[model samples]
Target: MERDSQLELYQAVAVRLKEAHARVRSLQVPEGVRMALSRKLLAITAVAKHDLARAARRLDRLMKDLDEGRFPEGD
Candidate 1:
């Protein structure tokens, strides 16, 4: 129960951090800076999406292991 709670807290923190980063990244800027920021943000979003896809894959693997009774407790 404690571990589950901790995981939830960590997830919440991760979400908040991402949100804060996005907000900061959205700040106004000069035209040149805005263009660069837009490109950089696109790249960052692409990487983030790739990372999220990988995380989903890992979660699916974990679910499969759980279903197969392969993952150890406290893992």
Candidate 2:
């Protein structure tokens, strides 16, 4: 596949990941589980957010590399 097409796909995935992260941030925990499991849930959510952020950063770097003609050959 061509580099431009791969870059577009990366951009699309990054956008979707960002949107999903926003949705996750906007979610409310149900009242039933809020008292007992809230901390655990929040911790898990934090980890997920961190991972998503890392992925987004990597995607941004990839896009930049592609634009600058710095992408490694045979990638």
Candidate 3:
């Protein structure tokens, strides 16, 4: 991808990341579960810094899991 398009994808990823964090924080799950979800989002954010496209795909799957109520089990 060109630099310009990569920049655009990064911007979109940032927005989605922010939304995902908020969604995870707002979840009614237990603290452990919330923390696990938050950790996954953080991992995605870190991945975004290196591979925006891969990060975006991971983020999309995370969002889908959240939407479908497929949360991680609490410890």
Candidate 4:
């Protein structure tokens, strides 16, 4: 996918996850509703693990890019 497209997809997922989190936080709900919401929240919480795995995978790619002498000057 193109970089722009990939970024758009990421943004969409982020918005969805934020909304889900807010839903988990703001409602006074029943036991069943709370249980279901907790499960959904747990799935969102797994994003931290997913992010760590992704960072590990990309560490080499990023290091390679840096070693190739690519740098952005601070403005």
Model 4 residue 33 lDDT? 61
lDDT value for model 3: 0.92
RMSD of each: 16.3, 16.3, 1.1, 17.3
The parts of candidate 4 lying over 4 Å away from their true place are 44-75
Model 3, which residues run further than 4 Å from truth? none
By how many angstroms RMSD does model 1 differ from the true structure?
Answer: 16.3
Q: Pick the candidate with the highest lDDT.
A: 3
Give the number of colliding residue pairs in candidate 2. Answer: 0
lDDT of 2 at 51: 61
Q: Look at candidate 1 and tell me the lDDT of residue 15.
A: 65
Ranking the candidates on TM-score from highest down gives 3, 4, 2, 1
Candidate 3 residue pairs in backbone clash: none
Best candidate according to TM-score: 3
**What tens-digit string does per-residue lDDT give for candidate 4 at 16-66?**
556555754565655566565556455544653466334333433433433
TM-score of each: 0.37, 0.38, 0.95, 0.44
lDDT of each: 0.48, 0.47, 0.92, 0.50
How well does model 2 score by local distance difference test?
0.47
Q: Per-residue lDDT for 56 in model 1?
A: 38
Candidate 1 worst ten-residue window by lDDT: 66-75
lDDT of 1 by residue, 1-75 (tens): 977865665565456446534643564545565455345444544544556444434444433543464523221
- The candidate with the higher TM-score, 1 or 2, is 2
**In every candidate, how many clashes are there?**
0, 0, 0, 0
